[model samples]
Target: MGWGWLSYSYWFPRVHSQNVPNSALFYPAVDTDVTPCHYRIPAVYSFGSYLFAFCEQRLDTSKDYGRMNIGLRKLCLKDLGRCEDDSEWSKFCQLPLLEGYRTMNPCPVGCKETGKLYVFVSAINAKIHEAEILKGRNTEDFKLFVTSTIDCGESWTPWQDITYNFNENVPVGSKFVVLGPGHGIELHSGRLVVPGYFYRMPSSFTEEILRQMPNGRKSPPYNNVGCSFCLISDDKGETWNISTTSDNFTYCVVDNMYRHMGECTIAETVPGKLLLNSREYGNGQYRILAESEDGGTSWKQGKVCTQLRDPTNRGCKGGLAKLVLEDVRYLIASNCGHPSARKNLTLWISQDDGATWSKPWTVRDRELCGYSDIDTYMDPSTGTAYVAVLYETGVSSYSERIDFISIKFSEVLEKCSY
Candidate 1:
């Protein structure tokens, strides 16, 4: 709640009738059990006729750390690329949890060549909080695992520990590494890219320093740097590589202590070009934008996109997706439109490959919302393109419900009023 200057809210001159789309309550919060549960971090993936929604079911509290499991709901598109009806979605089901560990970050990528759905998750010791990992307290407390479903959501392969592939190539001084916490992308060349970020421990970090720190420090560890990149897999999900080229990593300058990049999303702008959109964690209210020419291997220097405004202090997670309309490409994104608090969930469109974006149209009308994922599909038979969003929204807080909404590309074009 101590958003500080980043909590500056933009109040429009006038309020207009909301152009809300058709949305269904996909994952509603539960208060019936002794341990009330709330769903957060929504990610949506579309494969064939099914669209899968995934989130973290925080049992007992809405805090990041606790007993958490990945919750999934499968929706069948009665008509290809359509899921407006709530009846199309299946009941929410809790995914199998790693014993003694809490599973977070539901990053799923579908393979175009093999038709398999892969979900990457971070398994952490339930007792080990993110603060401990950032402080280098116990590197072994974090691990990365991925599971796949060849038959859609009907079944899944056993979880495979892929931590070695990452741990071995972590940046020289990285301590904390995490997955997309959203949906991943499969490029045209069949390269799978999972958006990720890691924190690099400064040379000043030491056990003695940890002991000397204040009991309840509010700010992040001093001098610790955060960077954003993608995890690449060439031969499906058989093996992986971290994008470590000098140009591949994106982070803000060290002049500001709290200005760090985190929780990013990626999309292929064209055949050989890629765009990585990340949230600036500190007082930087603008969304950070970076580009790569050769898939996810390397990236251009990152710059803040003034067109997209993010709430200050741990900016909310947004979704990115690309769609081709009559040979023209467009990038669609969703996030909190407000500059100060987590409110005014909005949708934006970039026509010139993210060079500029239209003024976003509010999606939630001042409702408290957080974390969203955008996915698009074109009906083969009709050639009609549609975009779908899975997001968390509530009146008083973000821990209310994860909702699903879909609108046509035609509607997006009409709604994106410059």
Candidate 2:
């Protein structure tokens, strides 16, 4: 695989687990047949009594080697077992969600106040080939776009490109921008927020450095550093504002290359405060943390989170969800517990906002586990609550299949040693 992309055989068996007693059900949301290359970056949200899952459907097209498009599959709360039928699930749109562009990172959010669902995606114009990018050819920068639905996942509005809105707020030289690739949150006050990052390209390009570059370089063409921020909407999904970027924070470097903070997750830890958990791309061993006092408008400098570890400096993406159980607010996070390997997918509970976390409960111990998203729902009939996790897993590699696991609140409280 080029550019360190993981490659898995097409014949890998679909692995599903229901061994956990509290897990109501576990199954593979997508297999190799649905996407020949792989189904990557899963995002899920609950709308009414149904759960919707979205992923980047990777396939080879005539123009691009493995072009990606957003694909969706849904499950009914009343009958999780029936999702196995091919006809039960359907795409959010008939054609590619963002046609003609290389789409990635599907971040979906639902607003109870408005009864609408929104999906945010990042795309780069794939005009240049991979070989060209490796050879220091400058490709077009990324653009942010969004789509919304009023009636669950039945239909969606056309893609609304919001690149201009983002570019207007970012610094003049900012080159690329991307969103949560997982799920966003609607604060109790009705404000919506989606965590994201932007890469600031070098101010000036030197011909000498460009000419001296070696072949097969994995980094982008320009010497860029990523900074985390958030996209906030005060008037629902009609408009958005880019929060202050976290560029003042001290970034770590390894091998003379700057490590950038990227792909963050945000949760309203308190009434007016937000906690941003970021992936450290540098020598830092723990996830980066930043605080916002006024909703998502501005952010403080990021610091290393001593408790959360990211081994080998290759930080993995994590999921954060807010749960209120028995009148106590809790924050639950899911990530690979190990620093270096994407194994031991564990869930941690935080009772005092995010100041501290309890011991984690291992969701998947040994197999390959990677990017994950968490969403919660309360059954109206029984008043019982459930948390659904959609993640990447496989027997040999994490890209083999996307899986789902539903666990009850009672099980978490009993298992989590708070």
Candidate 3:
């Protein structure tokens, strides 16, 4: 139990079935502890049978860094384990410019022939670690905000400033960064790979994503730590351009070795053979997949899943949510554990699609501190499997708060297909 203890109480992680084949967990009498679905960078989407937990209701301390205040909650997919009656749950603070501050990191997807649910969030205002160090200093005034929800979570419609010009005349780069996995695939020519991500901020980075330098800080750090593009929204997510990757990876620092591409998520395997699976935090750690047949623009240089472990030994900037159940392939990621240990919060699975990965269990072990997140979904008509995690037990010095867990993959595959 290395750096364990998620504090508070109610814990769950019991899925070994018989001999542990599809091994899964969380059944502490049906999981459920403390929760508003917590947030330290959260985003979960399960649509339909219901499993949507968006975060960052983190009011302000200048913003993002001030942390916690962006809100939206809805749970009822088997109550995710235990505890219920939060007086009949109902939350909504649909980004009123994140009043009081702290936006979030959401990427909801569900377009099954237009069941309608397209959420791609990243609406910021500063403070979240200085909005990634002011997009590495100046990303055209660093202010990110993108919102949409065509009905599935009830209602939410304002805010959608993606700008998305992409011709590069003066686009300053930075948007989406990556929000894959929601199924659109028609491509053989129909065109529809809205996999999102194009970061490289600091042309004055703020003023709510200022269009073209309302005060884009006057442009400075060319590529401090950016570069991740690919946007082709031909009428699904409603329009986007720059289908980059001919040579568009504009931010890299070799020899001394530095890389870019944060918050990625893609999983489509048969149409044009797409597999992107991403999550790499600069300098180097692991969890790369990269393989865009003709869809993600271009990418084919990452095949390391090292059983998933990178608790910040100088690396840990989390984001990775995948799903594929039945054919297997599941992933809900978090960093700061292996050595960097943000107090244990890792989860993994892959019947094969990330090539090779296994043995990364534990929703949030529980010892004494807190900070947790995760999300998963697989329901191509009813294979039924949805996981949503949120744990934050007592802040540093010992005491904060947030806990809510849910897991159901046929009840851990009927107790591990044993």
Per-model C-alpha lDDT, please? Answer: 0.78, 0.68, 0.46
Worst 10 residues of 3 by lDDT: 19-28
Question: For model 1, where is the 10-residue window of minimal lDDT?
Answer: 8-17
Candidate 3 lDDT tens digits, 221-323: 2343344444555565565555544443323333333344444545555456566544555535554556667665565544545556554333444444556
Relative to the unseen true structure, what is the C-alpha lDDT of residue 324 in candidate 2, on a scale of 0 to 100? Answer: 82
TM-score per candidate, in order?
A: 0.89, 0.80, 0.28
Per-residue lDDT of model 2, residues 75-191, tens digit only: 666654313333445433322456667787899887887888889888766654443432334534456788888877777899888888865677555555678878888887889
* Top of the candidates by TM-score: 1
Say which prediction, candidate 1 or candidate 3, comes out ahead on lDDT: 1
lDDT score for residue 210 of model 2: 32
lDDT of 1 by residue, 1-418 (tens): 6656443343431122264655555444332342457788899888777878898888757888988888888866545354555665676676666888889999999887888889999888998887788778887989988988888777788788889887556666786789988888988888999999888754423444344334453344444656788999989878877865655566654333335688999999987689999988777778988898999888775788888878887788998999887789899988888777787778889989999997777866757778889998776667788888888887677768787778777877677656
Where model 2 places Cα greater than 4 Å from the true spot, the runs are 1-35, 61-65, 80-96, 129-141, 201-222, 244-259
Give each model's clash number.
1, 1, 51
Better of 1 and 2 by TM-score: 1
For candidate 2, the C-alpha RMSD (Å) to the true structure equals 7.8
